[model samples]
Target: MTQTAPVMRDPGEDGRFGDFGGRFVPEALIPACEELHDAFRDAWTDDAFREEFHHVLREFGGRPTPITYLARLSESLGVRVYAKREDLAHTGSHKINNVVGQTLLTRRMGKTRVIAETGAGQHGVATATAAARLGLDCTVYMGELDTQRQALNVFRMELLGAKVVPVTSGSRTLKDAVNEAMREWVTCVDDTHYCLGSVMGPHPFPWMVREFQSIIGHEASRQMAELGVGTPDVVVACVGGGSNAAGIFAGFADSTAELVGVEAAGGAAISGGQPGVLHGMKSMLLQSESGQIEEAESISAGLDYPGIGPEHAHLAAIGRARYVGMADEPVIEALQLLSSSEGIIPALESAHAVAWIAREAGREIPSGSTVLLNLSGRGDKDVAQVRDILKGRS
Candidate 1:
């Protein structure tokens, strides 16, 4: 048997990251995906397109979000901690960066509407906001259960004039929401663009979304350099579909930073899952013995998925990054801890990374080493859920 050497270079025509990514959609949608791929490629290279994208991001999406030092957390954990505050970005999450870029691409493709799937609701809200700004009609599919849990964001999306559809099939979570979104896109491919919320879908999509979200990593890297820490010992972010983690890791992928992606224990695909296909791309997935896709359970809606982004699977495969899981109990504790320690409340999805860092302070991560964390979103969306959890505990 021969061990396949790590291939970390850009994926070519096959649109793969190792054996994990490619287009696997309905026949009717292949042309749409290809169109999107060609448009993105041209737009990505065109100076005017690049300038417009950056201009929109700076003028509307809020680029270059600041970094904050978690002094109290660093003191308690014995690991110097800094956070790239994507939470402070417009729309209160890193989702805005990807959504802004995708929405711009949507108009470039002459699509009059955008559709998206969201579980935690941040992406849906961001999509709606961007669509409204661009005068494009927006529709967001969310799991029925998630719609109930994240009702506030549902209202926020509607307030931005996007229609919200609740998906009721197959566990009624992020995965099902994605299924619904894809089904909808197949029927309206000509006029609607599926603004995928993560780096989990077919070809072009995984690559495209990552490129949009890469702004986070690029900004953080320069900020770290400006702060006198040219490179940190570790770069950490939570992974569900892995967009935010991929974005932040992109900045440090070639560096000596130990890239760490923390997943909800129930959905720790890279650590506990097998290679399987879901949401159009083959990646590490939580599956049953017969290869049935399993349901992922977590208190955080954003981290509630059965698989990880294909690129993340590749990263883990090539040993370029490490993946770990954190349970719900510690996620709550970490969220509360950060809120109290630094007066900053992190989304439940982001709290998984915080928990892992605290849990691994002296174990996987050496003490006194500088660690950079991507605070992917603010916790306002999760406050009600947390309040209920605390009430139940009491």
Candidate 2:
């Protein structure tokens, strides 16, 4: 196969990162998706739209997120570790970044409703927050299992006036929730914008989602430069549908930085799975010989997924990133270690990357090599689950 120059993109038509991404939705939803695509294109190019979006990010979503050096972690790992604190965002997760952008576009498109899916409920909460702020009706679809697991977030969404619809289909988790959300979007496409939480999905979604999230990498790059570190030697982030990782990797794509995407070993799609379709996009997925999506196992509710974003599939195939896997045990260990050592407790989703640094890699990342990890969210959402793990609850 011949390698071609990577394609840079405009927002609408067919959203792609290379040939890997395209809108592959149900026929009924195509026009709605196209409308969203066009709206995002115009919004992205409009200075006023850009200004309003940035203004919200600055005042509400917390723009210019800080880069914190983990001195103790660095001393222990032999690498200068820094964390891009997306966890510090208002909703305590990076999911708000995309939610804010999509909500703005939703208003611009004259949409009166917002629909979304959630795994850890971070996205649901983020979407609900945006909906409440914009006074749009919001509905969040979550797997039954997730609703139970992330009950606090479910209540949080409800408290914010968003309805949480519990889906009990398939594995009854993130994937099922995604299917439900898509179905709802198909039915209500005229008045509903599906606020996708990740850089996966089909076509314009992955592209548009990444554009919103690019703020992370963009701000981090500028901050690092100001700190007199031109570029880090490595950029690390945990990948579920690969949004946060993509966000942090986008700005550094042209630099010499070694991008690393950490996957949950129990559900390590890149290292353990084949290319397949799920939730409308084709990518690496843990699947059976019969091509059914396999059940994923990760201590982190957010990091367990059968499929990844298509661009991540492309990146993994092309060696643009070093994808590594860390199992359940080490992820727990990292969560505990971070809490004890640094007085910082990270969401288990983000801790999966910290696990890679803590135990997965055979050697410590080299001394003086600056490594930036996208700490995607706070750990408050996972306290109950972690307590269960600690107490040996099933």
Candidate 3:
């Protein structure tokens, strides 16, 4: 997750990113959020703290994952395609980067346990791994449906000594898992840190998590320059809670590159959403006219959230970045195409970016344009689910 550093458009002290991001949590958690804000502020400025974070990411979690040029796929699409290979990072996803930083912050805060919400379970696995390494108790909340769909990841988390609690509330998916986690966090805010999986959530979380994940963009920016590619024409990544996209976008926000966030068609908050607040942040959400948060359905469990990170909403509002959605049909086709052409299978969430590039090539993307796609996660955890879906279709 290492990269060259770039200045980000950080929110004000009030955490408002142009009317999009702000704290909207229960009173009980305000003190905790304040404490986290202060702690992060201090730790982020301290050279020692920054060194420890990078050291752990480099030595324990794999940092500086390579950027691979998709030669064949580029030729087929009539665009030069390159992938920022976060799938090769520890725990097989970009989830490891934020968790590693958060778990370290947890230890610094003298917390003894970590609680997290997961949909596809990569965050859970990464949290469990970091907790085990630091000798802290780890518990993961996942929707009952996601537990069934992502059983392999559940097993992986348990193997790493995490307690997996299957949430059985509304929808039984990422949204429900978040509800359960937030409820649990209120009860154990003193002794446990709620390790939010994405750049959503309240106040410092969206900002803090983006700061942690900015390594992706920072590194990719420098790496692209080193390869004589300079800045790309477009930078694309899948957006669930939008952490990966935020991370990669931070690298090129000030550049000439166009930023595009691809979302699951059924859960596209930025494209098919309204202004609303959910999970403590005011962002674009898939909600009904009555302001009820709708259940987001997607073939990718990780991208099944009802809302996007607040910063993403701000970006879209200001015309800094554009977002689009991809249906399941083309997403599946894109995954197969990448697997066969590049010999690299992407997680269903990550495949959304590939799907967008493949479908938009020579159309919205222009011929001979250089495209940078964030390969956010690997397909190992999704292989079984994809198999089931493919078999059922057959």
**What's the TM-score of every candidate structure?**
0.97, 0.95, 0.97
140, model 1: CA deviation in Å?
0.8
Question: Backbone clash tally for model 1?
Answer: 0
- Determine the C-alpha RMSD for candidate 1 after optimal superposition of all C-alphas: 2.3
Candidate 2 C-alpha lDDT tens digits along 181-248: 99888788888889999998877788888889989999999999998977888899999888999899
Candidate 1, pairs of clashing residues: none
Better of 1 and 2 by TM-score: 1
User: If both were scored by TM-score, which would come out higher, candidate 2 or candidate 3?
Assistant: 3
Error of 3 at 270 (Å): 1.3
Q: Residue 158 of candidate 1: its Cα lDDT?
A: 99
Each candidate: how many clashes?
0, 1, 4
Q: Candidate 2: where is the Cα deviation over 4 Å? A: 1-12, 360-364
lDDT of 1: 0.91
Worst 10 residues of 1 by lDDT: 1-10
